[model samples]
Target: MKSIVILIFFLSSIIGLGQDYIFLESKNGFREIKLGTSVENYPEFNRKDNSNAELFKLSLNSKADYVYVGSNDDKIKTAKILFIYLTTNNNVISEIKVVTEKVLNVYAILNSAYGEPSSKHGDKWIWKTNNIECSIEGDQNTIPGYHIVYKDISNERIELKKMKLESTKKAQAEL
Candidate 1:
C-alpha cells in the first residue's frame, strides 16, 4: 500500500510539471499568450517597423487550462494562426499551420478569452473570439478564414463558416 501511494504521488508530480504557459512577442507589433514551450523566436515573426510588438506577458491559470494573448497594437491588419502541441519534455510534438488569405483583423476594443466550464454544468469549455473579422477577395472559391476551437484534451478542430462583412458585424454584436 505504501509503495502504491508513493508511485501515485510521483506520477502526479510529473504530470503537473509538464504543463506551463509562455508569452511570445514579435518585433512587428504582434503578441500572443501560448501554452507549452514550443514557440517561434521573436525575430522570425517580428517586422522592423514595429518595435512595440517585442513585449508580451502571459498569465497561467492554476490548472494550465487556458492561455490568453493580448497585443499592444490596435491595428492588426492580418494574422496567420498556428496550433502547437508540446510533449512531456517541453518539446513541440506537432504543429499545424492555418492559412489565411483574407484580410483578417482582431478587434482592438475586445480581448480574447477562454476558460473551462465549472463541473456543476459538466465538462464544458468556452472561447471568445472577440471582434475578429475577415475580408476575402471576390474571386476566392472558399471562405478565407477558419474558426479554431478546443473540443477536448489533445483535440482542436477548425470549422469554416461563410458570411458577409455586414453579417459578421451583426453576429459579433449579438455575441
Candidate 2:
C-alpha cells in the first residue's frame, strides 16, 4: 500500500507539470508566430496575396528577441518585422518595428529563462541601432512573464510591457 501511494503521488506530480509556454524556432533562432487554435490553420508565411504577414505562435516553451517578417522576393526586399518578448500567457510581445530589404524570415532569441541565472544575474536582452548601444536588466519585476527592455548605445532604457495570450490571438487573427 505504501509503495502504491508513493507511486501515485509521483505520477500526479509529473502530470501536474503541464506545459506553460512554447517556443517557435527554425535553425537561425526564434520565429514570430501565433499560438492557440485560431491561427494554427495558416502557413508560416502565406503567399496568397502581397502580404508580408507571419505569425509567431507561442506554446509552453517559446521565447525570443525579435520576430522577423520577410518578403517573398528573391532579394527579400520590403520586410516588416518586430521584436517580441514572452508574456505571462506565453505570448510574444513587442513594439519595435523593422523595415528592410532582402528579407527572408524572422526569428527570436531566447533571452533567458524564468528565475534562471541569466535572468537574475545581469542584463538579459541587449540591442544596438545606428551608433547607440544599450543593455537591459530583467530583474526589476518578479512576474512570471517576458519583460522587454530596450537600451540604446548611450545607456538609455525603454521598458515594454508584457504580452498576453488573448491579445496575441486577436492580433494574429487580424493578420
**Prediction RMSDs, each to the true structure:** 19.2, 20.4
Q: Per-residue CA lDDT of candidate 1, range 93-122, in tens?
A: 122112222333322111221122111112
lDDT of 2 by residue, 66-97 (tens): 33344444121233323332221222222222
Model 2 lDDT, full chain set: 0.31
> What TM-score fits each model?
0.18, 0.18
In model 1, which runs have C-alpha deviations exceeding 4 angstroms? 11-40, 45-175
Off-target runs (Cα >4 Å) in candidate 2 are 2-34, 40-48, 53-113, 117-175
Task: Report the CA-based lDDT of candidate 1 relative to the real structure.
Answer: 0.27
TM-score of 1: 0.18
- In TM-score terms, candidate 2 sits at 0.18
Q: Residue 38 in candidate 2 has what lDDT? A: 26
